[model samples]
Target: MRPLVLLDVDGVLNPIGRRPPGYRRYRCVVEGVTYVVSLDPRHGRRLLGLAEATGAELVWATTWEEHANDWIAPRIGLPSLPVVAVNADTLPVSGHGEMFKTPAVAAYAGLRPFVWFDDQVWAEDEEYLRVHQGVGDFLLVHVDPAHGLTSDHLGMAKEWLTLTGFSQGS
Candidate 1:
């Protein structure tokens, strides 16, 4: 089976603060509230390219959930993908500053190899991955919340996929 690519919204595809050079600000009204989301069109294309190159399945791992398909995906030109449902109440607190989503992410990944992209993942999460999810190839990428996802990050993911020999039908 191909590896799964777990994608985050804020911090990964969307950054906070001033827009970066390649990004464009888009305003949308959801439930009568106007919100502006900064996104890079290239990111969607690059992500799609990466999935094709690596034969990984892209999935929504953000709080946005199905809303990502309703709103964000169209803006960035991405097709709808599977969503990893997470509930805050059931989140595991390790007292190690590990992200609350860590356990949920791991559960969603199950025994499948996956690449996780998020801004809040920390050392504790890494430790958990090492101890628990170490049986298979997994890459956790921390994207800067202020900058969002970049070409360099994408390249690194591609390189890791290549280095790990995780190709199509693997």
Candidate 2:
């Protein structure tokens, strides 16, 4: 079975700083709040290549939504992939509510295993993963702000793909 790889934008693909040798942090004002960002472009390309080589379906799992297709995909050399938009219907009662993209992702993935790359998975994610353990497999991958996709993260993805009997020829 093919696995889906959910890509996050902010901290994963686009960092708050420059790439590689000149990795530095910078502040950016988005919407109204200022955010500290830093992502490596090289790592983003590597991830795109890995996705292509592994036959994993890419899905946008960022708050940027469709904008990720326009702004982020180009830098990474990936065309438009599917997107899991945030559900605004569920209102948050406290300090920042959960935007569970899992439902949308699950719908898109069907019975396929999926890997979620985001900086925002919380208690809801844990609960969801617990309940749907057998229906569809989910892997939560956390990317560091300073270092893009680490060896460990890529290794995990590689292992999953191999274990599931997925080929690199999608």
Candidate 3:
């Protein structure tokens, strides 16, 4: 079984900042609010290349949810991808201080190995995975919100894919 690649939008693809060099600004309306997100044009190609190299399924794990396919995907040249449904009643709800997406991502991953790319992932989330999900089968990559996903991060994902034995096609 191919490992799942869970992708977050806010910090993973669309970085948070005053628009760094090479990043383009895009306005998207979600829930009646207009949000301006910074997206690096290269990210799409890199992510797609990663998927091709690892033969992993790229799944959306962002708050944008289905809107990711509608808005962000085309902007970055990605085809439609499976989205992990996250709701208020889900295990990752607020007030727990744990990342609202941690449990949801884990649950979505099920027994399949997964690699989660998010900006908000912290040590506590890692601890939760260590205790509840064990270690080797999963990877939680915490991206810097200011820098977004860099070449180093992609390198890490590729390395994880290789280390986890997910690398087969490329």
Candidate 4:
């Protein structure tokens, strides 16, 4: 497998901040709901670099879904990427600890090694991935919604991918 880098748009890319330094704000209207987003263009380059260094394919895993491809990708200078089929508006799972999107993420990843960047990852989500029988080496990079993605998060992913032997799929 080529491995995967899963990107989340809302909290991971668009921080909780209304407007932050070094980030450009954009207005995106999808189906009549206008959303304002703060994005740093450098993040695109950094994410692409990570994927290249590790021989991974970047995929979107966000509630924004396909809209991410239209609005978020171009702003960050990233090409269109595959999106995990998960709905953020989906109701919570009966399991208290598991995230609603966890099952879809698991299904999409299958046996591939995946690095997921999201602000909502909890211990239970990590455990869910870890205990799965067929999942490959995975890294859950917890991005703070307030600050968005940082170089430190990318470093953690690189280190994990390298240590796990998933780097370059070698």
Q: Using TM-score as the measure, which candidate wins?
A: 4
- lDDT by residue (13-120, candidate 4, tens digit) is 999966567999999999899999999999899999999898989999988889999999999989999988888576446485877888788888999988899999
Candidate 2 to native Cα RMSD, angstroms: 4.5
Supply the global lDDT for candidate 4.
0.87
Number of clashing pairs per prediction, in order: 0, 5, 0, 0
Assess the local accuracy of residue 9 in candidate 1 as a C-alpha lDDT between 0 and 100. 87
Between prediction 1 and prediction 4, the one with superior lDDT is: 4
lDDT for position 46 in model 3: 91
Candidate 1 lDDT for residue 36:
85
TM-score of predicted structure 1 = 0.90
What candidate 2 gets wrong by more than 4 Å, as runs, is 16-39, 87-99, 122-124, 166-170
Full candidate order by lDDT, most accurate first: 4, 1, 3, 2
Which pairs clash in the backbone of model 3? none
Best by lDDT: 4
By summed lDDT, the worst window of 10 consecutive residues in model 4 runs over 87-96
Q: How close is candidate 2 to the true structure, as a TM-score?
A: 0.71
TM-scores for every candidate against the unseen true structure:
0.90, 0.71, 0.90, 0.93
Deviation in Å, model 2, residue 5 alpha carbon: 0.9
| CA lDDT, every model vs. true structure | 0.83, 0.65, 0.82, 0.87
